[model samples]
Target: MAEWALIFKTAIALFAIVNPIGVIPIFISATDGWPAKDRAHTANTVAITVFIVLTVSALLGESILEFFSISIPSFQVGGGILVMLIAISMMHGKQSTTRQTPEEAQETAERNVIAVVPLSIPLLAGPGAISSMIITAQQSGSFWGHISLALPIAVVCLAIWLALRLSMHIAQRLGTIGINVVTRLMGLILAAMAVEFIAHGISGLFPSLAS
Candidate 1:
């Protein structure tokens, strides 16, 4: 049915926005010293955090923005800057530097917060996702429209879970080179998304700019 197609489109849009593949390097960095037994736990924790943040944001971020008199254009500009910086870092093969600052000669690795930081915030529920969800919801005034958008959010989280769960297998098969390739490719995608956000902001800022 038409409704199913809408859901599929929403899922793809969310998938592009979430891009689990983009977060792999960050995940590896976070779990660098974690025991093998704990890797799954860490990934699950990260995935769960992402799910919670994104789901909440999807449901209420718009309300919060409206209540605060915040503009999506402002978020578009700020979020675009953040995503572009992260994308550039990923593209240059330095994801560790992209999100968290290094521990700096090992006083003690700040590994505990990795799941919540780069993994959960920008990686999953960052500005791009939050903005996209708000826009999608507004566009989705009807019941089916809401369902369409919600399906994608759920699917994106599911993809994250699967990716993190299979991280070991993925790393083994891909090797560093493969992971690098995937990282850069995802970076390119992220870069494009960032451009869209910036454009959205700028367009809003100057109605006649791009026109």
Candidate 2:
């Protein structure tokens, strides 16, 4: 792997998936009722999930996609479509995403494990992130390449964890409106990222379109 290329790709993948800016509101909603101890645990859970998901993708995603005969470009196009749907939902407050679901509030009300399930799983590491990592892993065809990409992936997750830990302090100052503002801003970024993914996949499919 080209060291810089792996770092950049990993960074981009982590940004598009984790979306720390987008997570602000969800973090607020989920941990609103919890004590400090519980909130700390939730943040830790989110970070752990990120690492686990990426590690799995690094080890197994390529084989899984190969078993289905799915090409990386096709997967990227499909993943882009899925991510666009997620971005649209966030912008307008749609229910399919945990970040938007009424069920999320209810779950927060009923349980203490909010971050583990909805927040970390679907909201943070949902279909978009999973597919993105899988496609990336498939593209990383060599052991050295995958290994090189892994550290930056870990660093990104660390940043996300730290960001979530600080959301409480920021939330105190800006409140829900601030969270909403961040989410919307990140939504715009996500939409742009999705478009770029589609464009890359399309370019791969129709190379002569540029000619």
Q: Which candidate is the best by lDDT?
A: 2
Off by over 4 Å in 2: 91-112, 206-211
Pairs of colliding residues, candidate 2: none
TM-scores for all predictions = 0.72, 0.79
- Report the Cα lDDT for residue 81, model 1: 74
The local distance difference test score of model 2 is: 0.71
Misplaced by over 4 Å in model 1 are: 1-19, 22-38, 96-98, 101-147
Model 1 has an lDDT value of 0.69
What's the true lDDT of residue 176 in model 2? 65
lDDT of 2 by residue, 124-184 (tens): 7767777767666656677776776677678877877887888877767777676566566
